[model samples]
Target: MPEVARVVPLPHEVDPQPQRAEVTALLEGGLIRVRLPDGREWDAAWLQAGGSTSIELAAHDWVIVLPPAGGHPAVVMGRIGPSARPPRRHACASRRPRC
Candidate 1:
């Protein structure tokens, strides 16, 4: 593949590449805060499908961060499988009852 030139969302040592990060917070400006593997936090832009049916990104969700390309800002590509939401519990089960 051809080498691509890009810039990170913020000034940091992390090279421009696809990386896994945990969503920490969602911003009002269509951006989100993510903590890198190095424990550094950065504000990044988000990209999602247009006509969405029901896909929401929440805190603690694992997402892919696509570093800026062609002068674009970093984007939260999308949430990965195994969401952060707790699994559904049964009322007759051991722990907490289902609401």
Candidate 2:
């Protein structure tokens, strides 16, 4: 496996604001995936509707991201599912906590 970071979402989780644009950017950037518990899979950019938790990032470890689009950072009400791989340097490096 080439090792990629995955961002998983939980069901019924509410996002303070639906960041469809940001998610599309990430998907177009080729850095995200949607992992379903039922074994279905999809690209991050494919996420359209709001309130979907069954998202996952495969290949490398992922860090929760809250983009500063509006004055308030986008919120994700889900967990980054457990990973069997080590955290990738590019995953958390060059990132700072939002003030």
Range of the 10 consecutive residues with the lowest summed lDDT in candidate 1: 2-11
The number of the candidate with the highest lDDT is 1
TM-score of each: 0.56, 0.21
Candidate 2 minimal-lDDT segment of 10 residues: 16-25
Judge candidate 1 against the unseen true structure and give its global Cα lDDT, from 0 to 1.
0.74
lDDT of 1 by residue, 1-99 (tens): 944544445557547678899999998877788987889777787664553326677899888887655455668777789646788777778777569
- TM for candidate 2 is 0.21
lDDT of 2 by residue, 1-99 (tens): 744634545334444342222122244454454333344333432322354434653444333343333233243333345644766688668899899
Q: What TM-score does structure 1 among the candidates reach?
A: 0.56
Which candidate has the top score in TM-score?
1
